[model samples]
Target: MFHLLLVIIYLAFISLGLPDGLLGAAWPSMYQEFQVPVSYAGIISMIIAGGTIVSSLQSDRLTLRFGPGRVTAVSVAMTAAALFGFSVTRSFLPLCFWAVPYGLGAGSVDAALNNYVALHYASRHMSWLHCMWGVGASAGPYIMGYVLSGGGIWNTGYRCIGLLQIALTAILFLSLPLWRDRPGNGRDSATRQEEGGGAGDPAPAVPLSLMQIIAIPGAREVMVTFFCYCALEQTAGLWAASYLALHEGVSTEAAAFFASLFFIGITAGRAASGFLTLRFNDTQMIRLGLALILAGILIFFLPLGGNAALAGLIIIGLGCAPVYPCVIHSTPALFGADRSQAIIGVQMASAYVGTCLMPPLFGLLANHISISLFPFYLFVILVLMFLMHERLLKKTRR
Candidate 1:
């Protein structure tokens, strides 16, 4: 059972990362295929956010009524089908239609898995679960780039990813015998006070209500910090490769290598963080992660050229490395276990705003100015995040 759980987790994390890496790698190709403006491209990139936001309205009740495994498997299936449909569509309208279902799948899996994990597993496992997402996300681009480079059609790359999603769904289906609907004690919900879980204990739960979750003791700050953190992470991710290609004049393959470095760095950092959190306070780690990200974004935007800038991107990746897992792991700990899912739902939905906001903002900026100006946007957001971090959950950290 334990080994099977590890396999499911590894596969699930790969699904999380698939879209993350694919978006950046496929951005240029999508632009060329759709012949859309950068603004539209940015909007398209974030359309899933809108879908996830809407579906979050029902995630809790849905999970409560149906078991997490069933919900998770169904959602993963939806995401896979959506991605498959998205890969084949020649028109934008149908593509938009597909985004809605994809978002629903995204929202559902997000809520179900986090809640199930927190309710059943250790806090440290929560870190590992999300880190799996980073790993999958990091690897996705390479896979996409490989297909494209090997003379495969662009849509074929997406289909390959869809197949990967199907594989993950299959694992969940096959593992149903082992997954518990009600998390065993000290595992998922055990740490929640209402569930006989202790307060202030580490473990993430599925977020329930967006409106209500934000009202919790330190949730607002976590959201704000997450907003800042996501904006920086997403912006750097979605646009950095374009900056390298369009501005630096690197080839598509070379540019992907650069972006892969960032994701790879993130994956490496997340993997280490899962282990690190077992012995440390997450807040302290968050602070350190934020500082590293701040410096990395600054380095990415600096006037330097050649190997120095490349090194800067690596540094930036290292900086961003721990911030996400640290913040995500902090959710259930901050909100308590039972309400953790609700709070995380709110956090994830609200968190999408960052993903939605920056890509378009960067797109608009890029349309008006140089891609060099692109890094400036993230750099500015990084500063705000740095300043905002202290304000985020200020009272709670004390």
Candidate 2:
């Protein structure tokens, strides 16, 4: 029963990650079809981020009332509806508008699922669960690049995705009955009490006075480190394709495929990290990851080096792959598993801020400068993340 439930959750997470890959593939078509610029294409990311922020903020309440499985169904349904909306969008404004609900749905699912898995599942499974997301994300775009047929009639493409989402959502909903029922599994103590629970369960500790969580040796570093890591990552995944398509003379289909390369790297890296955790501590893995990312980001921009740069992007993918999920798996141990969601939720909300800021910032940057220059910002963001991670880990050890 446990293994079956774990597999279902894994599949659900993979489905959730599919949009990351698929969205990039659709960008060029939307631009050509709508007669919009690359900057406008970037707005789609902002809109999605905005939706994530709203849903994340509300996630505690939703999970409190309906349980993770129910919330998961609603979020997945919202994602399907939004994907369908993207398919049928008549104009740019309509498409931009749909992102709100899409983000809401995605954010809800992200918070609920991460929290549920953390509170209930083992640390090892946490890495694998997110790996599923990476696998799904990698598949979403590669399929589109092959199947999109010159990026015309994007509806045909998106409708297929919508069908996929609907199918995935149905599976998730049917499996909803399998998720365990528990109150405050991932929230802070007070929040848990409001949701109803007894003292008998091995509750995650919470302080009565400060209201904010105190860090364990390594957790604070992990949280802040991930905040920067995810922010940088979300920026790259969401904007890299638009940057290429808008300015690099790459077709949307091709640019989307390039974007998928990053996720593919991430998928491989994350899946590897799932097992690697058995062999390495978070700090050692992170240091190695940071080194690769630094090298990879530079190689990605090397002059007269397309193939090398592509290889670098893959390395970047491998480097970026583990940090977020590693931090996630580690968070529960750092913060009591019970309060893992609320603490991580706050950190993830910060990540949403990065997602919100980067798209429009890059969009406006691309408006004035060039899309090539836009990626420079991501590079800088990554360096900052690495430094922050180093600092956070130092703090953790003490």
Candidate 3:
């Protein structure tokens, strides 16, 4: 049953990722059909991000009240409905409306499941589970592309993923019993025992207010670290092609294909990191990832040309693969398991905040200054993240 639950959780993560790439892949066709400017997609994205932030902030309370299984099931169902809504929308307005639930569903489930796995599972499982997400994210664009190439509308692509989400939602609901039947359940009793609690002691993990969570030692540092990590990741993913085309003089088509190497590296790297976690701990994995990111950035600085930029992006993606999962997996240890849910909730919100803000900020800078500043921008964020992780280590150790 425990393994079954793990399988279900993996499927849930995949569902969580399925919609992420859909919009970006379909937006070109969508905008033309709706007669909207290409920029309107950003508005929908912002709406979704706003909803994600709000729901992520609420995840601790919701998960505590309903349990992760219920939260996961309900959130997946919400996204399914939202995707279905998107499938039938003709105008841009309805798409924006649907983005609300789409975002809300993603945030709560992300926080709930990450915290759940962090408390209940090994670091390797965390890495593997995120690898599943990358698989789903990669598959989403392919599905959309296939639909478009097959003469089906973008709406058909949305409908296809919506159907998949609905199926996963049903599986999650049926597996709710598995969640409760597990020995540890929500807050692992063994963990509490290790923390000096008796076997029969009541669970100490009450939902914490945002302020209360922030007051914990190392909480601020971890949040800033998450923000910085996400800022760098999203900014790079968003602008890599443009930077290659504009600054490196790569052709637009070639740059677009090369940019995909970043995500491919992340997906493949996570698969490898899962195995590596058997030897290296979370902190070690994070340090290795950060070091690779630094090396990748340095490669970008070398006067090697467009090919070097492509190589740098791939290396950077490989570096990113371990950092997110390791940090999330370490949350229960760095903070107490009792506080992990709330802390992870805030961490997700901070990540989404960075996702929403950073790419656009870089766009503005690129417009006024130069796209060549991309590596410099990533370097600053990477340095801040590295410093924050070091600070987090000290604070948690003390």
Candidate 4:
């Protein structure tokens, strides 16, 4: 049953990634057809991220009320609806309107599933489940690329993916029973305890109010760590191609293609990280990831050969791969399992906010100063993330 559940979660993650990659792939065609400036995409993205933030923060409440299975079902359905709306829309305004549900749906599922896996599954599963997400993220662009290559409209790509999401939503709804059932045990919390050789009941620590959860020690620090790390990750991802093209003198097309290595590295690295968890704990894994990220950033800034920038981006992706999964997996252990849901919800919200805000902020700085400073911005965020995570760990341990 656990394995089955994992499979469903993996599929859900792929659905999440499908829409995510679509926008970037379709935006060029979209802007041309809609007669909007490329910068207008930012407004749609910000609206989506805003919706994600709102939904992620409220994920705990929704999951508690509807259960993860139903929430997952409904969320994906909402996203599918939003995508279908995008498929037929003629103007930028309608796209922005649909993005609200798109982001909301994605955020809720992300928070709920991360918390669920952290509580019920092993650390290795956390690593691998995220790898599945990487696969989905990569697949989205390919789907869009295929559509564009075949002379199909961007709306066709959106519609096809929306249909896929609808299919996944049906599966999720059917699998609702699996989420409700605990194999060979008591309730979900009891199952968690039994699987871990009795960590004791975690019921009391869960279902916390927002204020009460924030009052817990290390909560704010954890949120800050998420914000910084996500900022670093998204900023690097959004700008790596431009940075390579501008600074390393790489061709624009080559730079765009090479930037994908960051995500590929992340996916492949997670496959390896699942094995590493056997030898290292979550905290050690995160620290190692941070070290690698710092090294990658340093490589980015170095005056190496033409291929150096590509290598740096790949390395950064690899470094980023483990940190997110490890940090999420540690939530049940760092805070009580009872509070894991609430904490994870808020953490997801912070992550979205960072993802939404930092990339634009960096773009603004690049507009004013130099795009060459991208590496430096990432370095500062990485350093701050490390410090914040360490501080949070200390408080948790105390």
Candidate 5:
């Protein structure tokens, strides 16, 4: 039963990742069809991000009312619907309308699943689940690329992915029973407090309110850590292809394919990290990741051309691999399992906000100054993330 739940959670993470890379890959064709400026993509992105933020903030309420399994199933259904909408939309305005549900679904699933794994599973599974996410995210662009190569319309790509999402949603509905049969599923409820663990522990029977969660020692720092880390990760990903083509003089097709190495690195690195967990604690793993991220940025800035940039992106991917899962897995240890659901929800929102704001802001700067500054931008974000995480560790210890 536990293994079955793990399989569902892993598949859920893959679904979470599927849409994330779709827009970027399909936008070149989509904008052409809609007769809109390529920059118009940001509007849809912001709308989705806004919706995600709203839903993520309310995840605890939804999870409390419906349970994680139902929340995940419903969220995936919403996203699947939105993706279908994207496939059928003939113009930009309809696409904007659909993005609302897309973002909301993404956020709810992200918050619900992360908190569930943090509570019920071992730390290694967190890294492996995120690795599964990387697989889906990486597969998205490949699916679109295949469609484009076969002379299919951009909508065909969206349609294919949407259909895949629908199938997963059906599977989710069928698997809802697995969650109910799991142990300790109701432990966080006040009604279950007497049967739950000891009193006065960090994870109380009653969940913390948002304000109360933030009032905990290191809460603000962890929020900052999430924001900075996501900002660094997303910025590197969104800009790497452009940075390579424009800055390193790589061919567009080659750059696009090579740019995927960032995610590939993340996927491979997480598999490696799961093994490394045998020797390293969470803090040690994070510190090692930060060091690799810094090294990757430095390599990225070197004038050695496209090959160096590819190597840098891969190294950065390796660095990013462990940071997210490790920080998330530590939430229960940092505060308590009682507060984890709320904390993880807010963390998802904060991370999405970074993903929403930073990439575009960097684009503005990249437009004004040159794509060459991509490495510099990532370097600054990496430094801030490293410092904030260290502070979080210190505060949690004290």
Candidate 6:
């Protein structure tokens, strides 16, 4: 039953990722059909991000009240409905409306699942579960591409993913019993253990407010570290192709293809990191990842030719693979398991904040200054992330 539960969680993660790449892939067709400017996509994206931030901030409350299993099932259903809404929407306004539930569902499920796995699973499983997310993210674009290539509309692509999410939602609902049957099913039990109470000595689960969570030692540092890490990752992913084309003088088509190497590296690297976690702990894995990111950035900084730049992107992606999962996996240890859910929820919100803000900020710089500043921008964020992570380790040290 535990193994079956794990399988369901993995599928949930995949479902969580499926819609993430859909808008980016289908935006071109979507904009034209709706008679909106390409820039309108950003508006829709911002709406989604805003909704996600709100829901992520509420995740701890919801998860505590309903349990992760129920939260997961409901969240996936919400996302499925949002996707189906996207499939039938003809105007840009309805798309924006659908983005609300889309983001809300995404944020809740992401926080709930990450916290649940961090509490119940090994570091290796955390890494591999995220690898599953990367797989889904990668597949989303391909599925959309296939539909477009086959003369099917972008709506059909959305409908396909929506159907998949509905199926996963059903599985999740059926697996609620598994979640309940697991030991430490409720926050009260988990909090009791964290408080050093034996199973026989029941204790209340005191909820941590956002202010209380932030007041915890190492909490602010870890949150900032998450912000920096996500900022670097999203900025790099968003602008890599443009940087290659504009600054490195790669052809448009080639640059686009090369940019994909970043995500490919992340997916493959997470798979490898799952195995590596057996030997190295989370802190060591994080350090190694940070070092590789630094190295990758330096390579990008040098005039080592276009091929070297491509290699740097791949290396950067590889570096990114371990950092996110390791950070999440370490949350229960760094903070207490009792506080992990609230902390992880805030971390997810912080990550989305970075994702929503940084790329566009870099776009501004690239427009006014130079796209050549891309590597420098990444370096700045990476250095901050490294320093904060080290500080977090020191503060949390027993």
Query: What would the per-residue lDDT of candidate 1 be over residues 1-398, giving only the tens digit for each residue?
Result: 76677668667766966875576677777766777765565465567888887666566656555556677788898999998997898866787788888888888788667766755565567667777887676577778899989988668888999998998889888876666535443234422322333556665444345567666666776667767777877777777788878876677787778877886787677677777777776677777776776676666556676455666677777777777666666665555555655656666676688877877788887888767786678777777776666666665553
lDDT of 4 at 182: 41
Off by over 4 Å in 6: 181-186, 189-204
3 or 5, greater by lDDT: 3
Q: Candidate 4: misplaced stretches above 4 Å? A: 181-207
In candidate 6 the C-alpha lDDT for residue 356 amounts to 92
Cα-based TM-score, every candidate? 0.80, 0.77, 0.95, 0.92, 0.90, 0.95
Q: Kindly indicate the candidate among 2 and 3 with the higher TM-score.
A: 3
- What global local distance difference test value does model 2 have? 0.71
Question: What local lDDT score does residue 97 receive in model 1, on the 0 to 100 scale?
Answer: 82
Runs in model 3 with CA error above 4 Å?
Answer: 181-205
lDDT of 5: 0.86
lDDT of 3 by residue, 38-95 (tens): 9999999999999999999999888766777788899999999999999999998889
What RMSD does each model have against the real structure? 5.4, 5.1, 3.4, 4.1, 3.8, 3.1
Overlapping backbone residue pairs in candidate 6 total 0
- Candidates in order have lDDT scores of 0.71, 0.71, 0.90, 0.86, 0.86, 0.90
Q: lDDT at 27 for candidate 4?
A: 95
Query: Mind giving the per-residue lDDT tens digits that candidate 6 earns over 31-102?
Result: 999998999999989999998888888888887667778888999999999999999999999998999999
**Model 1 TM-score, 2 decimals:** 0.80
> Alpha carbon lDDT of residue 66, candidate 3?
73
Local accuracy of candidate 2 as per-residue lDDT tens digits, 90-174: 7889998888888889888998888877677665577788788877776777667766766446676667767888987898778
Candidate 5 lDDT by residue in tens digits, 247-306: 888899988887777878889999889888878988889999999999989997667878
Q: Under the 3 Å rule for N, CA and C atoms, how many clashes does model 3 have?
A: 0
